[model samples]
Target: MERFTPTRYTLTCVASGREFEDEGWTLDDPECGEPSLVRARYAERQLNVRDDAYGIYRFCDWLPIRRTLRGSHAPVTYKSRKLAEYLGLENLYITFSGYFPEVGARMTTCSFKETEAYNVCARRAEGEERVLVVASAGNTARAFAKVCSDNRIPLLLSVPEDNIGALWFEEPLDPCVKLIAPCCGGDYFDAIHLSNLALSSPRCYAEGGAKNVARRDGMGTTVLSAATAIGEIPDYYFQAVGSGTGAIAAWEANLRLIEDGRFGNKLMRLMVSQNAPFTPMYDAWRAGSREMLPYDADQARADAEAIDAKVLSNRKPPYSLHGGLYDALVATDGDVLVATNEEAREARRLFEELEGVDIYSAAGVALATLIRAVREGRVERDKIVMLNVTGGGEERFRRERGNRVWNLRPHRVFPLDADKEQVVRAVEELFA
Candidate 1:
């Protein structure tokens, strides 16, 4: 596969309809004034970056560059005729990336995390000068480890201690990639704290977290890849969002296509789903502001701390950035759905019955949300739709592991209230 090496970045201002160089940051004074977005564009398209001063860069505008390094876990599906006829849309396609024998399964997830790895690593300074710090739960660590190890990019991943078990990859993570699960019991947000500290190190670079263009752009390939397979992008975009990085990526991809004069900017209404137990975004959307409710974050964190899927819940979502995902929702008149545990299971069963596939829990939320949208009349039956099955490799995969799992744990731990200097000492132990 061919990879792009661009010399400069592109800057765009959505509200103003003018684009310029992203010498640094761009501000948006929303006439709406409360909780509006001001975005920073890096290139003509999405670009994933790892710069010392920038923390993360050009990730949004250049997110599309991410699709290059990933392998598929599912197929571009058009077999949902029942769904298609029901949606009342002309073209309906399913972007499936899971573990079924048909789709290639990587070690970490039934869904394709490979898409994230591909884009994150593709746009980097040549000669291996960059270091990426990934904050994940289990699956993302495993996925990123596979990608960084394959690309020989150094990655320092911080995951919650309990979530470590799911870090198993189809193959052993490459030695160059560092794994850092918390030594104590907390949650995904706790792990993110560690990653934030790691990023402050001169030797380490953050994956841009939710802001990384690579993650959002690369993940959007599920949409683009499906669109190419189906001959058109859908009028509605459906996905289960923890961080909602993928939905943002999809919106950005559709924007780029419009800029390329190929696809219309009439994006599919982004129908996003979240686990009901962790529906901060849902609550915020319901209340009519993009602001995060402090009580919801505290409550959700405390509740999810007891479980392993906490990584799927991000307290701070990137919804209000200029041209960010929240903006996408407003522009498309999108709606948010919260999936109950029962609904997720039912959706999973329904999917397995109709599509002959078992999806990840997150994907189940998406499928369930889509069903809810359909049943509740939020989704017009005649509109074109696209559903992104982010991952499902765990249930559908048939591949034998090429390697064995390793007994791993956090490299070190702080007091959870440890200062920066203490964290710095911990990060230095992994240095080459």
Candidate 2:
């Protein structure tokens, strides 16, 4: 059997409509004047699940990767009886991406970011000399660090110092994986800026955030799992977003499923949420603006600091980009919702009590919005709904692992305004 084979797919720029082949990590078409995401056009029109494969690769038919790696886990979807009854809806389902062994969700990182990590790393060409740089809040750093370490892929992660606690791993990472961070008081956007400066090195390439086709397609597997489990696409899809990348991925998956002719031909209305005080996307959507209104930098940082869900703290998200969350919302008749810290906490407690699993702050935000939608009569009781538990089973996973878990300490720390040349030179030396 061939260990490596190219996925039969072509790439299309969402802005220019230019079609091209995958170059492993192509984020956009430079020929197009406007910045936009490039989407994958798979040759396999029908969704095909490969039984021989494991983890996210089970739905590899739609992913943009030349190979699959070890220790990958797919999202698990199950009908929600307890939560469904509590919410008074008949067709409610939970698509979970974490370490709930009872449901067979074996993501040790205990975050849906594993979905993005696995696919993105796999999309890189084998033995590529360039070191991949990624910016993250915390969960994403943990996910990418683990995946790249496991697969022996060279990677550099820039994470917010405040959210560094989220980087605990099941074991020590390989030397090929390195971690860095903006000093305390910085946020996700700061981490992104640090990584951007590091990208100035010719030896480094960016693992594009929302712009990465591999990442969006990777996250799309959550919808694929739900559709395959429920036998059709749900009437609505719910999740919490910092970048709104997962929601866009869900919408893209819905399009592919509709084209597959197996799942029901309907686009699931994306019901995405954001943590209160840091809700730029929600604010933009509600104000009916294509562009994000001027948000003071100090105010944005202050608001981000006030939110419990620190991971949902991207001040500059892909909301206004072509084929981004804005287009996704408009195309699917979606609505952006906001949840307060108090509301999200209550929702988390309720979910754990009813569903018997702890979830991340972002998942709590998602559940809180679903509750709000129910109370506001935005969602009907009888409609099929999928509530995405982006991350859960953390307490349980950690408890089980015990002393085996280790935190990924940063190799270097920089002030928010660190010089670009300084960052680039230091980053290059790590791989040198």
User: For this target, which candidate reaches the highest TM-score against the unseen true structure?
Assistant: 2
Candidate 2, residues 65-104: lDDT per residue as tens digits?
9888898999999999999999998999999999898888
**RMSD, every candidate, angstroms:** 6.0, 1.3
- Model 1, residue 391: C-alpha shift (Å): 0.5
* TM-score (all chains, Cα) for each model: 0.82, 0.98
**Total clashes, candidate 1?**
31
Where in model 1 is the C-alpha error above 4 Å? 1-9, 13-77, 81-91, 103-109, 128-130, 296-298, 305-309, 398-408
- For candidate 1, the 10 contiguous residues with the lowest summed lDDT are 49-58
The lDDT, on a scale of 0 to 1, for candidate 1 is 0.63
Cα error, candidate 2, residue 277 (Å): 0.8
